[model samples]
Target chain A: MNNDYYSKSYMPGIIKWGKITMLLGITLCFLPALVISFVYGYMPPAAAILTGLLSQVSVSGAFYIVEPISYFPILGIPGTYLTFLSGNTSNMRVPCSSVAQEAADVEFGTEQGSIISTIGIAVSVMVGLVILTVGAVGGNAIVGMMPAGMKEALNYLLPALFGAVFGQFAISRPKLAAVAAVIAIGMTWLLRNGFLDFMPGKNPPSYLVILIAVFGSIFAGRLIYKKELQVPEEEKTEAK
Target chain B: METGKKYLEMANSPLMWIAAGIAVFVVLMQSVIFFRKSLKAAPEVGLTKKQVKMAIQSSAISSIGPSIVILVTMISLLVTMGAPVSWMRLSFIGSVNYEAMAAGFGAQAMGTDLQHLTPIAFSCGLWTMILGSLGWLIFTLLFADKMNKVNHLLSKGNERMVPIISAGAMLGAFANLAAGNFFTETNSLTIGSAPSLACVFGCGIMMVLTKVAKTKNIQWLKEWSFAIAMFSGMFVGYLAR
Candidate 1:
């Protein structure tokens, strides 16, 4: 009952034969994709087909990967294989899933998991595949019936959703939010400037920009809240 | 490649929800057992069990406010800028399904991709804001859910922290001398990184002011620094293309 039995170790154990299973499944999955891409001349197959199980590390490492891929079948095997192997599911989420759901409520324990609940998972996976096919083949056609401009503008949906997220945080502590904004901008600018350029690096400062912003914010957080030091309640801590 | 696509398809299949359901069930079952175990062996009657339950209740809904704010902020900007609805659905659904495939672009892609798609100029205003909002959400959320004793999502956290730290920093004086870069693809008027640095450093000053500076007086500094930083980001983003 204590799913601790689903440890991270199982993924690698599963991966011990990943290449074989994938290689075999490739003819079924990848080969057909290649044929389609060649016919349509889609060029590079839009990454969905180009990459296999490596999608976990290959992608941006956000949350909810499981939900979508699990529902979609084709996207699930590669990412789930790699990520599940590592016993980490964060790579598939919205990146801020915890902000909306608590650790305790979500059992956010980061312990590596194994393949313990195969039956329930397998059932869900089958259901997911049906929905994905129906959605992709039929949904696109039906949804594509919309105006081109409207369709184009629809791209903004996610950003708006994310904005809503920011707005919520801003409401929590407008002043602190404002401060974090300024610091993040400054650190971003500095990192993109000549300073890090002078230091040795291969990828350039752009990649490090996120890190700098985090540091600046953390530094600013400690400094600004220096006076309010105390043990946070477990409830409050879990909400973090 | 067909296999790649197949895998991706399989990954995205609704069937995979079974996996998630199972995982959820497994976790819930484990949690119940864990609580029961702790309760049975506890020094007191259900003390830790009560605490964990309390923790779950208090923590579960705490994220509602900030979480929605950031998501709304990002989604609004995207909507105003005319991004695709599919993209929007994908942002949330992408992860829920297999976000590892779409990545976070489902959140940050609106402005950049739209700009790239159209003949119109770029718009960084929403993008930077989107990035910040997402980053902020990530930081706050991680603290709540991560079971790892150590933190790994540290980079994004810094992005969120900067804004908080800058609430009190003073703006440094600077001249706009940008014929190219930062903002303005043609007008040549741009403060660029110069202003951004000032904005962040000013936040530092503001943090200092948060206490010593008169409470009423402190508010303006926070607003000013935030505005300048966001504006700078927008300019750079809108113009960078």
Candidate 2:
């Protein structure tokens, strides 16, 4: 029989504890790094003192950790996994979904009576974990060989990526895209290439140029459109 | 004696490997959470299953660029010096805490009468260098792509909603790159560092306001939220940093 109705979980206390224990087990397993770093020089004394002063204000995955290295957000591991290994080593993608489906398919009081079905989740999860551990160990050796400095020469990663994205803007709001791009780019170009040369890093304080370019386009557009944007109709219906 | 000392250094600290393991675990858990993908996978938030797959693929490919750079930079540096890989020193990026590692050795050297400056060849510090490089490269790439994809996603999924998420991710990426300069300044030259953060923040604000004020007032608020949220994210990151 197909189980259809969706409601809250009816899992047993043991099962709930099992899940919590598994999570805690993983969390506590992370302690060795602290213990070992201490031996080699994981100076809590130093880090504690410095962390207070340098925390906050980074622009990266600042979501994951309390503090990462450069004040730039480091999205911890999943982001890292996504970045390095095209896919997560854990077939986490498939199995997690499978587990959720199992939970859903499980008739609140009924069980999948067959032996294979009964033991299937436990077995598959074990198999998946073993495979994941193996892959994690092996993937690093190969990834170790990939190139990195290509970023500097190919500094256009941001622009090229955004260019394709903004191209849509150019297509839809050709005038607005043109205006904003020009102002942002021109000011950036001028600040980077022009008299801003007096200052290093090709960075200029934005009250001067970038601000002008960005706000100037915005205000100009607002005046032309009279503070009204052409929003899609679908969103309007949803909003109501 | 120095060679022997270097060889046994792995016993001194395993945190680097542990950090890598911890990091990987955290990542796996997150992937489980965020990649919850729709059952039919028809496209929630406008991402078709296929498009999401392409994005994941492309993101991985883009991230490889940095991983390759770090490895090549190390390998080529070793070759260019005409020194064996064993003799090479890795200057870890972003973390800037290598001095403490050196201090560990300095203490060890004092214990050994400075007779053996040689640290274990396959030491935890060495692994830390490798992990740090890998972490920074991957972290930088994925973060950039995620921010980029959000806009692409909104645009591809809904054409008109594009400008609402616009400018925020771009500004966020630029802000992160600008953070690199701050790290660099902290490490080098003892004197006054130029106002990198201010410039970054201003650039971010300008990107947001430009997109915001141009749209309908209601639309502008939505876009403004994205920008503010991104800055809030940046603030969260800075705290972590």
Give Cα-based local distance difference scores for all models: 0.29, 0.31
Report each candidate's C-alpha RMSD, comma-separated, in the order given: 15.0, 15.6
Give the TM-score of each candidate: 0.35, 0.38
Give the per-residue lDDT of model 1 (tens digit) for B69-167.
223233333323322221222222122323222222422232334323221111122122222223212332222222121222322343332223222
How many pairs collide in each candidate, listed in order? 144, 26
Q: Summarize candidate 1's per-residue lDDT along A107-226 as a digit string, tens digits.
A: 221221011112112222222223332433344444446465433333322222222223323443454455555544454455444456654333233434433333444455556554
Off by over 4 Å in 2: A1-33, A41-44, A47-174, A177-240, B1-15, B39-162, B165-241
**Deviating ranges (above 4 Å) for candidate 1:** A1-92, A99-132, A147-149, A187-205, A231-240, B1-147, B152-241
Worst 10 residues of 1 chain B by lDDT: B170-179
lDDT of 2 at A219: 49
